[model samples]
Target: MTSAKRVAIMVTCMVDQVMPEVGVAAVRLLRRAGYTVEFPAEQTCCGQPFFNSGFRAQAADLAKRSLDIFEPYDAVVLPGGSCAAMIRKEYPHLLERWPGGVARAEALAARTYELSEFLVHVAGWQPAPAAGAPRVTYHDSCHMNRLLGLGAESRALLSAAGCAIVEMHESDRCCGFGGVFSIRIPEVSNAMTQEKVRRADATGAEVLVSADPGCLMQMRGFAHQTGMRLAHLAVLLEELTR
Candidate 1:
């Protein structure tokens, strides 16, 4: 709301290496909405990688590093719901498993926010008008919806941006790209994702919208395999302002 309100962009590992533009776009949107945005390059992975990998010790260390790097900001925001859910929901549990984990994670998670949740609920963003638009559907990220309880904020934002938000049958279904789960069981993940892709196709939507790149990657692979087109929410939002 003012110059005093500082926002830290938590550019997750995937967004940092693969889709830096999504991070850039997040900064743009927040800055336009009147917040002073800053990127703390000292920040690295959010520790979920190791936690989900069954390496709790490494995860604790990584969590400590992340907490130190991002703790100073007034509010920390991430583009992906899974990463954000890690901060808001999973980090505390992971940290508390050993010594000095709960207090540390609580301190950090208190200030964390998902971009869409922050934009719509905290910033009170008004929807942009919708013209005749392509049929679009959103695949709710498991962590975001089930873990963070982030309901409709992403969809509301898209709808406001004038995109046709179609319900892809089981919109709340998991896409099977559960971090290490996919690597551990590729066939299972593929089957789960194929079902998701087919449901999206059933909506007759030209594009599939999702908040996380992991889901996007798996689903995109299936889409490509089936010759279907899918897009992430970051890319779709980027198109809205253009």
Candidate 2:
């Protein structure tokens, strides 16, 4: 058997602490695509929470530490779009100064990719045929959609995996899990998530899928009451493909 290509999995803090199954699904998917995945023990927060909270120094420190841990790998994959965007889109700008930081940040950013993007664009993965297709709607996390412009990648992957994609009203709308934004203004945050759940529920899909854990967790808060099933794209794809 041919050896698997090596890749690093950046399990964002939310997945590590809260929804670890997403990370597990990510590994399984990558492994099936012939990748040997590793999680750096030194990996921690992507510094996005600190950066979003205006803790620039703390964010910078964490970014540098993350760069150090992921630097050696040819490819680094993130299960969540928010953290992937933090590293790929914001890292260079966040570390523009600090003596040679720009080169390091840009280099790492070039190699980083969101899971679906990597699976489709890099690995050229075509999932195993599913026994049955599921009707699902997708939530495009703010960072995933606007920043990373990855709205198509996940949808494409789901279609390729035989999921019937239902377009929800304002499918690209934010679920209001903006890291610190939710905690600082929970009233507005909860209202946004409620609306998100409402739109998703209206689709009559079996599951609501999102690429970011933050959005998944936020929507899940209202999903139980709304009678909606929520899942990360990794988990959803894994289940479908298997």
Candidate 3:
């Protein structure tokens, strides 16, 4: 248990409103790994929605606010991979145009980390043994993998949890749950999500895991809309060592 000096939890907007349990599971995961954890009550949406929507000023303001909220910690542990990716990836670009705020946003990015990244890279935590775990497949979120470069850490952790890692076809494809992208481009988003759901189903995996809540929400919706069933990675991880 190489605990982080201080770890802050950043619960993204959708999770705050729809699925807070995912946030709780993240806290449990961190605390169990011996990280001193704190959740800033002032935290809100990571401004990604606005940023992605091309609202630069509003997104920069929200980014500034997030920097203020999280800058003091040794590491910012973002439960939602999309939010973590936004603070790290998009902020730099936002700062590129808004030079006045680059330092703060860049500093925030310097310390920010997705949950599994912090767990494995910073905190040095691993999943508890799960020798009899069910067949599980992972969906690598675009932001977490491509943007944050988390590599294969989450997949390894899931394997440690005693689950069979069934690699789905085009496992890296976007699930079309691009937050506002889904609403803005409903047909495209819906179609993409449907394809992802179909692929995951094709693997015959009992669960599909991803670090992004937006992806999870879209996948869950597609499951409900299309009558497909798959458990989230968080749901599976939370079920362990209780």
Candidate 4:
């Protein structure tokens, strides 16, 4: 077991390449919660895309690489829920065939947590109410909700931040950004995202918040049609706290 005060940040590929500000916001939030944050510069994709694409061998290699890089930290937290779920839910199965792999993967999985999960559960930290908190609606990304079972934790944090919670219909429905799934079938993905935006717009919320970067990216493509703004939960929280 590692020291509870030291934590590692797993900056997912989407955040690293597309929305780096999300990683910065995540770091700020972790520091605010009184943890020593470390970013392993060597960290890269968690092999989720490979695993999802049936490239198990390549995925296993990256999983082993990730484990070697992050295993030393007391806890691993990620801004993107899908990547967290990849480590927590898929690593063990992906590494099962290798000698001592399952045990190592399980150990890492036990320490890995989604950002909102780490903040609300491990840190037991709550934000001071925001000044003139904005009205917001939340989107439950697939891996975060179904695999991690973490829909309420984020909403609880948002509520604590004094944001008025507006429930969008089918909040847990997939935003159609299944990583490669969107790229493979963009028409279906676009349709799904449009429906998601329509629901959020219907709520009349000022911002549409999601803890998963993949979902945010997918919905953002349709931002022109919606009146509300799009925000990653980490960025929204960091802004609210400041």
Per-model TM-score on C-alpha atoms: 0.92, 0.97, 0.93, 0.98
Ranking of candidates on TM-score, top first: 4, 2, 3, 1
User: Which candidate wins on lDDT?
Assistant: 4
Write model 1 residue lDDT over 1-242, tens digit each, in one string: 32486799998998888778778878877776668899998977988878898898888788778888987887898888988888878778877766777887897788788888888866676546557656788899899899888858888878878878789888999998998999899999989998988888888777888888778877877786554467667666766755
Candidate 1 clashing pairs, residues 3+ apart or interchain: 95-101, 128-160
- For candidate 2, the clash count comes to 0
Per-residue C-alpha lDDT of model 3 across residues 1-242, encoded as one tens digit per residue = 22346688897877789889888888888788777789999988888888888898898888878888887877788877788889888887786776567777777888888887887788777787765688877898888888888748888778777788899998888899887899999999989998998888888877778878888888887776443346545556767645
Per-residue error for 114 in candidate 4, Å, reads: 0.3
- Residue runs of model 4 more than 4 Å from their true location after superposition: 1-4
Provide the overall lDDT of each model, using Cα atoms, as 2-decimal numbers.
0.81, 0.91, 0.80, 0.93
lDDT score for residue 3 of model 4 = 48
Model 3 has an lDDT value of 0.80
Candidate 4 clash figure, as a count: 0
Cα deviation at 144, candidate 4, in Å, is 0.6
Model 3 poorest 10 in a row by lDDT? 225-234
TM-score of 3: 0.93
**lDDT (Cα, tens digit) per residue for candidate 2, span 94-176:** 99987999999999999899999999889989886576878999998898899888978899889988888999999989997
